[model samples]
Target chain A: MIMEKLKLNIKIFFEGAYLSYVGLFRWLSPSTYLATLIFSPLTQMLFFVLIGTYAQGTDKAYFYVIGNALMNAAMSGIYGVTMSIGGDRWDGTLPYLFGAPANRMTVFLGRAFMHILNGMIGVLTGLLWGWLLFHIDYSAANPWALLLTILVTTFSTSGLGLLMGCIGLITRNVMFVNNTVYFVLLVFSGANLDLATLPSWMRIVSNYLPLTRGIASARLIIAGHSLTEVLPLLIEEFGIGLFFALLGYSLFRWFEITAKKRGTLEVF
Target chain B: MSAIEVINLQREFQTTIGVFNRKKKIVPAVKGISFEIAGGELFGLLGPNGAGKTTSVKMLTTLLIPTGGTAKILGLDIVNDAEAVRPRIGFIFGGERGLYWRLNATDNLRYFASLYYLDPAVSKKRIPYLLEMVGLTDRADEKVEGYSRGMRQRLHIARALLHDPEVLFLDEPTMGLDPVGARELRQTVRNLQDEKKTILLTTHYMFEADALCQRVAVINKGEIVAMDTPSKLKDSVNDLSVVEIEVFGIPPETVEKIKTLSMVENVSVEDRDQLQLLLVHTSKGAEAIPLLISELNGLKLGKVTTREPTLEDAYVRLVGGE
Candidate 1:
């Protein structure tokens, strides 16, 4: 039975990828990233490259590029999952999914897993781009550390996206969720700056977040430390990821039951 | 086992949403409605807007859990064995949002077929057959987004039949179709029923219900107001009359006077432009028409017409319009 449900879930996920060309993926891609991923990583690799060079050709040039890309990888799932789900609600297709006979967990994970592929695409493109632009070693990714980083990132961010999806189900607006996540992450995520250099209270706040600990751990691995060296951060970030995912899942399930009960499941 | 049994089924939405963005607004959608559908029956649920047909259909199909009820489809509990129950059912709704807009019609059917866990080999054969059944085989490769309302509705039906379940739940299956399209859809529904497929169809089009359903239920305000064969419901209103009048425009006083006409027992103005039907009654529709016309033309009306009692008239009576 378990195998059957898993296979069903996998089939649903792949079917989603073939959904349409004129849809969220193509409509949402910034076009610049599109050019680089297909063949030329050197395309627009110069923006951050310029940022690094302007900072006086620091050997850490490659590090910022990798960091930005990983940060985007963490966020790309949000872009993919939340938008697709928000689009579903916005378009009224959500009721069909909700009404389907499959388990909510299976359906939720099926859609969630699709975005992981999207996250991997964002990560790989940036990795290749960084390698092409500078002498930075792509081997900086400690295999085990890299996998843990990705797993943690996808879970936590997808949780954030899932929460957004539920909220969008209520509001039926994709633009609202998308813009809100973008700006909020821009400010608190330290994506644009070094976390260690933040104000003391801000640094303290960063330490308490899954994203911050994730970035710090990734940097540690890139600097040649083993996975075990970041054990405390790993535990902390992993726990936060689980918390967000479980929280999002529970909230979604509750709303689902409430909507069904109220007979408002098809309000859109 | 009976194809469907719903006993003392009640779904009450908490009038108020609570906590973590749970705003409290309780709206009871289905209230203690109970009925049974035998195997191979083409059952119809007819209701006006806000009648809770969708909610009831959702419950029976295992899409939404009942707040305080138990329903079994093919002897599988809707809640406890939903996954097992799902394979035994297929559902279709005509909302444009139902199909994946990006996928072609055939791909949409194939995707749903996979969810039913049909063997790949079977889908390869079944999809073309099912699409042909709905008459969309030629356009099956085009994205559903490009299909007209009728085409999409056809694709939705094809998607519903992909798994070939014993029971089907269809909400407004022919809602947006034209006359020819609606006729084809009703025919398709009848064909499925002939194959012993149990069907639950909710539609505002009483003609569809009357033509295709062997047994029908009418729900209003979240409760079953009436249920039985369509003929019986219509027979209950046997002495009823339906009057239709076409006028350039009606005057307020003329409408008021028509209500007081000797044989014009009850009269109400129907705003044809808005497509809102109003019910008026007299012992005989023909007896009242001349008076209805003189009163209308007396007010300089262009034309007026009256006709027989219909499923629409029965609907008005069931909804307690009289």
Candidate 2:
């Protein structure tokens, strides 16, 4: 019986990923997909690279280009997870999901699977665009370390996304919160700037933000550092990610019960 | 054991009074109510909007926590044993909103099938069988966005049945369908009854309830005002007949004047284009028609007829003549 339940949970997890993929992109026409998934990220990367070139010459162009490219992944992770719940809520399916006999955590965490995968795709796409367009040097970078950085970064950002998604259960303006967090990651992730230049308090704040450690580690890997040198940052990033995932799971369960008590699951 | 046993179930909602100075007001949506349905019984909850019919269904289905009472579905406490109860029941709130518009009909069913933990081999056979039952076999591969309102409602039914649950709860299942669609859906419901599935249906349509339900509970203002088989409820008004006065451009004052008569039991209106059909229930049927006509004064009168009381008459009589 326990084995049967486990098998069911695994099936449900994949089913959730498929649903989120279809539901999240339902509004995207072919043209819209091109504009959103491809054209938009490329343009943003180019714009920031051009700005960096003008500000600090060709030498600094790689900094702004890589920074914005990594931010693309963060954006996808945050928005994708947020919309996983938000889409269900708007479609009037949240009540059905909540009322189903399935385990709530299993069902909800399943939704994160596709978004994290999509975040990985977004990161890789951005990186390729940088290498091709700006001609960034990849020969010196360790591919295995870079892969580890991407995985850790995706997990950490997705953790933050999961927590934000829980807040979506009670509030209608989830996009407002999602966009706020997205911008916070962009500004303080140490993606574009050297954290040493920031104020002491701001550096401390950046340490706790999603992608700070991972992005810093990514830069180290690209600068031809050894895996041992980057391992600590990647581990820290993974730990923070785990914390948010657990906290999000607990928050989700609490709000679900409160919604049952208040009869507010179908409100928004 | 009874399929459902509800005991003094109640629910209250808090609403803010003002935008600036928010003060919460606890308003009861479902007052303490109780009832029972035998296994495989086709039970109906009949009420107008805000009559607590849906609220009661929500609590019974474990979607909402009851504030004051308890309910058991298939011998499992809805609050304490919610997870156990969910697998045994299926529900559909009539509309197109609950479905994934981008997914095809088959995909939607398959998705929810997993949510209910149906075995893949079982769902593989069940999904197509349900689509055939709801008469959506031809359009099973089409995206839900392309389907009409009636088709979407049928798909909603198909989705609900993917797991083959023991008890089914349908809330206003035919609220916005055309006559043909509504009739077809009702036929499907009857088929489910033949399969001996315990069903709890809620609707505002009196004729629908009368035609389908074995027993119905009339709810108003969050309370059960009346409960019985349809025929028995209609028999309550056997001594009373309905006097329907057809008036052209009848003023509200005339309807009010007719209600003031001592013999008149109740008054309700139905619009027929330029004509207003006034159904007046009274102990004196034809005798009261003349008094009603005399009371209308200078209104343009159309054909006036008198008929035997129906379940609608009992409903209006019991619900204070909505």
Candidate 3:
């Protein structure tokens, strides 16, 4: 009986993810995905690579490319999760979702699963872009470590994204909050800038951010480090991700109860 | 056990009232209302716009938390046992906004079926049946955005019935449909009634309540002003007659002048395309028709007729002409 229940819950989770993807893309044209998902990230990569090559010379181009590549995963996770909830609110379907008989955590985390997967896809595609454009060498790197880094990074960052989506329950204008979070992740996740370049306080702040540890580990793996060499960082990344996922889910439930009491859940 | 029960339910919302110098105002949306609905009973809540009909339904469905007092659905408290209550209830808020316009009608129903945790085998059978029942089988695969308003409303009904919930709450389910569409939807609702589901329907249309509900509660300003069988409610205004005047380009002042008459019990206006249907209730009946004509001497009246009172007359008399 327990096994059957778990299986059912898992099925519901995947179905929720699939439905969310359909909701996100049903009205969107193909060209819009080509522009937003593909060309846009590649252009940002090219621009950053060019600047890094010019400022610090050709040697640092690989660092900048890999850094920006990993950040795409974070972007997709944040935008995907935040927009999932925000879009429901805008379309006036949030009330139905709230009134559903399903468990609240299952509904929310299930909706979030696709965002995490999309984030990993973004990271992998960005890496392909890096390898094709910058000729970044990964022949000596451990493929397993690289894949693990991408998965962990996407998971952790998606938790933070889910948290931002929870904040969207109170402030219906999620775009503003998402944009602010996106900027913070870009600047403070140790992606574009080196840890030495940031002030001591800022570097400390970067430690607690979603992608910092994951990105650092990814960089080391790209530089030919073994999975064992980066075990501590990977562990820390997993812990952070789990912490955020739990925290975000708790906050989501808290916000839901409060919104019901305040009668603001469907006001938008 | 009663299918639904409420004791002194209250809900107040804080809103900023002014533009520049905003003052936080506490609006009592549902104020100290109490009621009971028996199992398998078709009950109606009749009220005007913002009369807290939707708020009360939302509260009962566990969508909103009440500020004070308590509500129980099928022996489960709405607040403390919401999860236990949810699986047994379904609701459909009127109009097309609630549907996913990108997905087709079948997908919409399938998605909600999963949300209600219906098994795949059940949804596979139930989805097609619901789509056929709502007369959307032909267009079930078409995206909801391409659907007409009536079709979308029917699809909303299909989505609501996906889980075969024991209790159903419908808020203004026929608000914007054409006459045919409204009648078809009402037939579907009547079929559901035959299944003995406990239905709590909130509608402003007295005829709808009179036709479908076994009993109704007339609410005004968040309070139950009247509650009884449709026949009993209509009998309250049995001595009154409704004089309906279909007039084109009737000025507002003329309608007011008619209302100010000593014999005029109440006046309600229904706006048609270019003409206005004025329904005036009075004990004088045909005796007041000539008085109405003389009062509107300048305007060209199209057709004037007097008929007996309906549930609508009882409603107007109870709510004092909203």
By DockQ, who's the top model here? 2
| TM-scores of chain A across candidates | 0.79, 0.93, 0.94
- Model 2, A1-268: lDDT tens digits are 9999999999988987787668654434688656666678888788878877887898876677667777866776777777775677778887788879888888778777876777777778888888888888877788988887888888888888888888887788888988888878877897767788889988998988879888888777888998899899888999988888888889888988888998888886
Cα deviation at A149, candidate 3, in Å, is: 0.3
Tens-digit per-residue lDDT, B221-289, candidate 3 = 999999999999999998899999988888888889888999998887899898889899999999999
The Cα error of candidate 2 at residue B20, in Å, is 3.7
Q: What's the C-alpha lDDT at position B274 in model 2?
A: 86
Winner by lDDT: 2
What ranges in model 3 sit over 4 Å off? A25-28, B18-22
Compose the digit string of candidate 1's lDDT tens values, residues B200-304.
999988888999999899989888889999888888777867776656556577667777767755556667673423346777767766666666565445444
Model 3, position A238: C-alpha lDDT score: 77
Best by TM-score: 2
Q: How many Å off is the CA of A176 in candidate 3? A: 2.0
| Candidate scoring better on lDDT of 1 and 3 | 3
TM-score of each: 0.83, 0.97, 0.95
Docking class of 2: medium
Candidates' DockQ values?
Answer: 0.41, 0.79, 0.71
